[model samples]
Target: MTPRNLLAAGLFCGLAVACANPQAELAAHEHYETTGGSMKLALIPPAEQDDDGRYLNLDPEGSHGSIATRLGFFGRRILTPFRAGAGAAEHTTEAQVSIEAADSVQWVGHSTLLVSMHGLHFLTDPIWSNTPSPTPPFGPSRFVPPGLALQDLPYIDFILVSHNHYDHLDVPTLKKLAKQFPDTPFVVPKDNAALLNKHGVNNTIELNWGEQTQIGNLTISCLPAQHWSKRGIGDTRQALWSSWSVTSPNKRFYFGGDSAYFSGYKLIGDALGPFDLVALPIGAYSPRDMMQGSHMNPEEAIKAALDLRATRVLPIHYGTFDLSDEPLDEPLARFETALQTMTNNLSALILKIGERHAF
Candidate 1:
């Protein structure tokens, strides 16, 4: 079958499975109705929650997108020829191993990153699968392979997941990591533990906004992000989504899971400014009316970096999977253009899929 046909077939199968699960659909609708104004959620500060226990975005008005609108976008997108761009120029395994002692960041494709700092290694929002979907061939296929093979990674002290999005929280990759490094902690936002547990990944530390945990010398904090969550038909917003902050004694780093432009960045900067480095998403933002509440465009990402008061900025969430309407290379192109016009001396860290940069 052609690629388009395969995608259509896979989507049909997935829909069929979802339809077969009547209880899940009913639960979803029930949750939505009960959530009415406030919601029931956990691991969050009371201030961030509603009277009924549902989690709320910093922007009360924030929304993922209308279902009809998204369906329209998907319909239009599927009809067009899929264009998998020339993949990123990945580096070698030896290069990855060489970054052990020095503080470094390696882009492993999409939001997957290998960050080593202060004697410990960290993997952020890891997804090594060719497709970021439970139902394969139905979702966007990875245009390039990961920068470093899973076996090439140094000892990972912590695996941080920012949200429940398929691209950020891939089960296959997490399962492999669980097997490879059984002792490492899998940190995630509140209410996400069950999913990992269901997949046999029992070593998880879940947190909510304003919550944190310590591993070795590092302090990992779960912060807010303007985004929504949904892994199945009716699981929308049932789990918390967040950005993350990892701080050692001398250096600090921020990994933005996925978020739209919001005033919360300024709040975060005021509370935890002067981050040494920040990784922000610069893709999957188009049809502004629909995406403005979820993903940030390139310029907004740059502004987020400045808001975080980051000394160095790394662009991510692009050039791997075709998740939105923008051209694959457009994010970086616009990022570079925005950087050239910046008044601050914020350094830009650009890397190929497998390339590593030491700080």
Candidate 2:
């Protein structure tokens, strides 16, 4: 099927599922009752027009024209069935395997990182799928294949999930990892535990903003993010979204799962200041009028880095999928330009799909 038709069908199917599943409705209500705060059921908001005479306050426009426009530009350059050949493998570095006092951080592509510090191993937003869609057959497929397969990862002690977006919280990848490492613990936002639990991920814990949990010596705090969550149309705001602050003895890492520019950054910085490293999103922002409230542009990301007081920033959420209108390399180029002004304060790092950085 054409990309347009596929998107249309997917939207239709998603809406259908959202409407038919009474369990989902009940689950959403129960979730809200359990954790009372500003609640959003799905990531995308209901279609609405802003005072600026544009459709800025709405869920993503999941239409044939929208899909075709993005695909027509990006489809030719990005690969499908995303298999990294020998050349891609040749660049892969053998990350320090020991879970203790390791010096390296491996990029498994997208937001997934294999981080080893203070004698522990952790995976963040692990997406091993060709596409970030709800279904494997269609959606925004990866532009570059994953550097390492699921089986290739070291024994992961903890899996950190930021939210329930398909790209960040993939069911298939989580299921495979669960089977491979049954004892691995999953740390996610409070409302999102059900997503993991539904997949038989029993060893999971949910936390609210400022709530911290420990696995071994690693202490992970669920921090607030100015973002939304939803897997399908009707289920909007059913889950909570967050960024994570992971602290080890020797190093501290801030993983910005996905967020827009918001005042929360200052709060995070005040609470967990002087982060050693930060992983922040720098992509999927287009037509700023529409995306600015949810996704951050490169300049905004740089500001977030500054606010977080991170020593170094690693840019993720780009170079992996064609999720927005900007060119594949636009984010990095813009980030580079933005860094020029800050001189000493702003430094950014891009992890070549499978590349590893020793921190």
Candidate 3:
């Protein structure tokens, strides 16, 4: 089948599955009705059209190319039962290492980070599921297991969610985390409070951009990110997206939660300069013509690091899932090339999937 045909089939399948699931359909309608707010979603111009005059939606942009075709290729190559066994083994190894560490941060695959500081543990965008789709049966499945399993994580004092996208906000993962750390507080974007509430996540605090809250001795401030958010197709931009500046008495860290290159980085730098570390997304961007507006390529990711003036940069959001056209290693390779071209004093600390870094 052609790429276009595959894309259509995937969409049709997803839509049909959504419609058949009464709970999903009801959730979609109820979410839109309550969270649509006064923001005129209808007034916003229709998505820009491509040459074919079809509205170019950002969520599944370039759906026909890398997303549909390459994913299909991998989906067929990997055997489900074997993959499950391997995933379990990998998860066990990483969890043992993470739990054994005395004072270090573990990259729990993708944007998930577990920071251990001042006797407190924090998890960022913790998605332990094999796939980041709304339904377990479809969408971007993890090629490998999460570095740390949900139950294996230490007593998490707090969880930070940047936005409402499935990749960033997996409801099942959150439900599991909530169950494990029953009283642990959750920090998320202001408008997304309802979604968590619906899932029985009561210990959630919503913050708009520039707002700060304290968890133990750590002071976390939500900073601006050049990204958009939505859980369903029609509820785009209903919630805000943001990076976060987490400061403790001894250290300051920045987590750039998936953003396009934008002036917001400079603003963040001006306000919160000389961070001890910055965790930035460095993948899932391809066919720049379509992705440049919402996702940053490697070079742009470097620029964001420079703008933030971080002492050490840790790249995330790559190497775990195949979300774009670029080769799996392209983002890191491009990052190295960009580093050589830079005259500024910027450095990066790239971690292996199960690696731990002491800050």
Q: Each prediction's Cα lDDT score?
A: 0.75, 0.68, 0.66
Where does model 2 exceed 4 Å of error?
Answer: 2-101
| Global local distance difference test of model 3 | 0.66
lDDT of 3 by residue, 157-216 (tens): 788998777778878889988887777888886677789999998878877665567666
The regions of model 1 sitting more than 4 angstroms off are 1-47, 51-53, 63-68, 77-81, 86-97
Taking the tens digit of each residue's C-alpha lDDT, what string does model 1 give over 1-359?
Answer: 57766565345322211101111110111111212333222322322656655677987655445777666666654533366565333435444546655788889988999998777888999988887665665567677888888997777888999888778888999999999988777988889999999999998888767666767767777778888777766666788889988888889899998988887787777656689999999888875667788889899999999988989899998888767777778889989999889646788999888888886
List TM-score per model, in order.
0.84, 0.76, 0.75
Better of 1 and 2 by TM-score: 1
Worst 10 residues of 1 by lDDT: 19-28
Residue 133 lDDT, candidate 1, scale 0-100: 66
Indicate which candidate wins on lDDT: 1
- TM-score of model 3 relative to the true fold? 0.75
Better of 1 and 2 by lDDT: 1
- The TM-score that candidate 2 achieves is 0.76
